[model samples]
Target: MSKYILPVSVFGTVAGCAVLLKQYVTGGRCPSKATIHGKTVVITGANTGIGKETAEALAKRGGRIIMGCRDMEKCQAAAKEIRGKTLNSNVDAFHLDLASIKSIREFAERIKQEEKRVDILINNAGVMRCPAWKTEDGFDMQFGVNHLGHFLLTNLLLEKLKESAPSRVINVASLAHIIGKIDFEDLNWEKKKFDTKQAYCQSKLANVLFTRELAKRLQGKLRWLLH
Candidate 1:
C-alpha cells in the first residue's frame, strides 16, 4: 500500500505540472470586461487559425468585425460561423491579399471609403517557413506578406485611423524575432541563398520594429496594442 501511494502521488504531481505548463505556454484569457458595442475591427487573415479565433472573441464582445482574407469564400464561411456562435450580426468578410500590394491598397481604399471609422486594425496574417517565392511586387514572400503588406496597409489607413482617434493597431509578432537579425544589404536575399527560417525571423523582427516606430509616431493620437 505504501509503494502504491508513492507511485500515485508522483503521477498526480506530474499531471498537475503538465497542466500548468500548458496553461503558461498558451497564456491566460482576456481579463477586460470591455465590450465593443459600436467599434469596428479589421482583422487580416481572419479566415483561419489565430486570426479566426480573435475575430470570434471580438464578435462575442459585440464588435463590428471585418474579416480580411485572400479567399472570400472561406472568409464568408468563417464570418458566418462566428456570427452564429457569437450571435453578432455585424460580422462580415472582405477581400485582402497580403501577397499583393495592389490588393492591400484596394482593401485599404475600400475601408476608407466605406467605413466611417477604424477602431482596431489587427495585422494577424503571416507566413512561416515556405519555399522561396516572391510577392507580386518582387519582394521576399515572408517579408512581403508579413511586414511590407501590413506596413503599406497601415500607412494607407493612417488618416482614417487618426479620424477615428484613440484607435488601436495590433501587430502580431512572433517569438522567432528574439534570434532574428535584419540584413539591410540583402533584404530580398538577392545576394545570398534563400533561407526560409531566417526569412521568417527577419519578417517578425520587422513587425516588432515597425510597431515600436509607429508607436513613437502615434504618440497620444492612437494606441499600439502589444502582446
Candidate 2:
C-alpha cells in the first residue's frame, strides 16, 4: 500500500470504529422504513457485510430475497439468520462465483429457470484490497469480479428486469473511484503492474459508466412508470 493510502485507510477505519461505538452507546431503534414490500431483491455476496444487511432489511420490509453468492454453506447460514430474525420471509441463496464467466452464464441460466422476474438487482459482489490476479477469462481480478461480472449478469437478466417493469439495478461504488480512469489499453492489467486499490477504483468507474449508459436506454422503456 502507498504511504498516503495507509494513513487515509487508518483514519477511515478509526472513524468507522468511532461511529460504531457511538451507535452502541445510543442504542438506536434503527426502525425499518424500506420500500420493498412484495418485491424480489437479488443481492450478490448476500452472505456477508452490506449484502447480508441489505437482505435483512428487505426481509423486514416484506420483500422476497434471492441471495447470489459463491459459498453455499455461508449462504444457507445467512438465509437461516434472516428467517430467524425476520418473520417467515422468503430468503434463499443461489450459487454464483463472479471470477468465472462460465459460472456467470450458468447463474443466469438458473435464474431464468427459477424466477419469473427480478424487481431489484443489487450488483454488490466485489473484492477489495486483495492481491492481484487474473481471472480464467484473463481479466483483472477486481475488474472481472466487480465490473464485467455484473455487466454480463445485467445483460443476461435485462429481460426479467423489463418484465418486472419497475426494476432497479444498484451497483455499489466508492470514493476510491474518483482518482481512477478507464484504461482501455490495459484494462485487464496485462502489461502494467497491478495495484489493488487502483483496480478497485477502475471497476467502480466501470459501474458508474455502465449505470449511466443503461439508464439512458431504459428511460425510453420505462416511461410509463414515470409520474
Candidate 3:
C-alpha cells in the first residue's frame, strides 16, 4: 500500500481537478421553471449535438419548434425523435443551408410567411476549424456560416420577432471568442493565407459582437442571451 500511495494520490488529484473544471465550464442549471406553451421557436442546426438537445427541452415545455437544418432527412428524424420524447407534435423540420446567402434568404422568407409569430430564435449552427473553403458568395466558410448567415436571418425576421413582443434570441457562441480578434481589413482572408483555427475564432468573435449590437438596437423590445 505504501509503494502505491504516490500514484493513487496523483490520480485522485487529477480527477478532482477535472471535475472542478467541468463544473466551472458548464456553469449551473437554469433555475427558472418557466414554460413556453403556445410560443414558437426556431433553432438552426437542430439535427445534432447541442441544438438537438435544446429543441427537445423546448419541445417538452410545449413550444412549437421549427428545426432548421441543411439536411432535411436528418432534421426530420430529429424532429420525430424530439416529438416522441416530448410527446409534442408541434416540432417541424425546415431546410436552412447557412453556407448559401440565397438559402438563408429563402428560409427567412418562408418563416415570415408561414409562422404566425416568432417567439424565440436560437442561432446554433456553426462550422469549426474547417479547411479553407468559401461560401457560394465567396465569403469564408466559417465567417459566412457562423456569423453572417445568422446575422442576415435574424435581421430579416426582426419584424416578426418584434410583433411577438417579449420574444428572445439566443446565440450559442464559443469561449474561443476570448482570444479572437476581427481582421476588418482582411475579413474574408483574401490577402493572407488561411488559418482554420484563427478563422473559427474570428467568426466566434463576430457572433459576440453582432449579438451585442443587436441587443442594443432592440433595447427593451426583446430579450437576448449569448453563451
Local accuracy of candidate 1 as per-residue lDDT tens digits, 1-227: 78799899999999999999978866877799889898999999999999999999999999999999999999999999999999999998999999999999999999999999999999999999998999999999999999999999999999999998889999999889998889999999999999999999999999999999999988999999755
lDDT of 1 at 112: 93
| Pairs of residues at least 3 apart in sequence or in different chains that clash in candidate 1 | none
What are the per-residue Cα lDDT tens digits for candidate 2 across 153-194? 989988888898777788877667778788999998778888
lDDT score of residue 64 within candidate 2 = 84
Model 2 pairs whose backbones collide: none
What's the TM-score of every candidate structure?
Answer: 0.92, 0.82, 0.97
Give the lDDT of residue 22 in candidate 3. 84
Worst 10 residues of 3 by lDDT: 25-34
- lDDT string for model 3 (1-227, tens) is 89999999999999999999988897767677789999999999999999999999989999999999999999999999999999999999999999999999999999999999999999999999999899999999999999999999999999999999899999989999988999999989999999999999999999999999989988999998897
Candidate whose TM-score is highest: 3
Collision count of model 2: 0
lDDT of each: 0.94, 0.84, 0.95
TM-score of model number 3: 0.97
Better of 1 and 2 by lDDT: 1
Off by over 4 Å in 1: 1-22
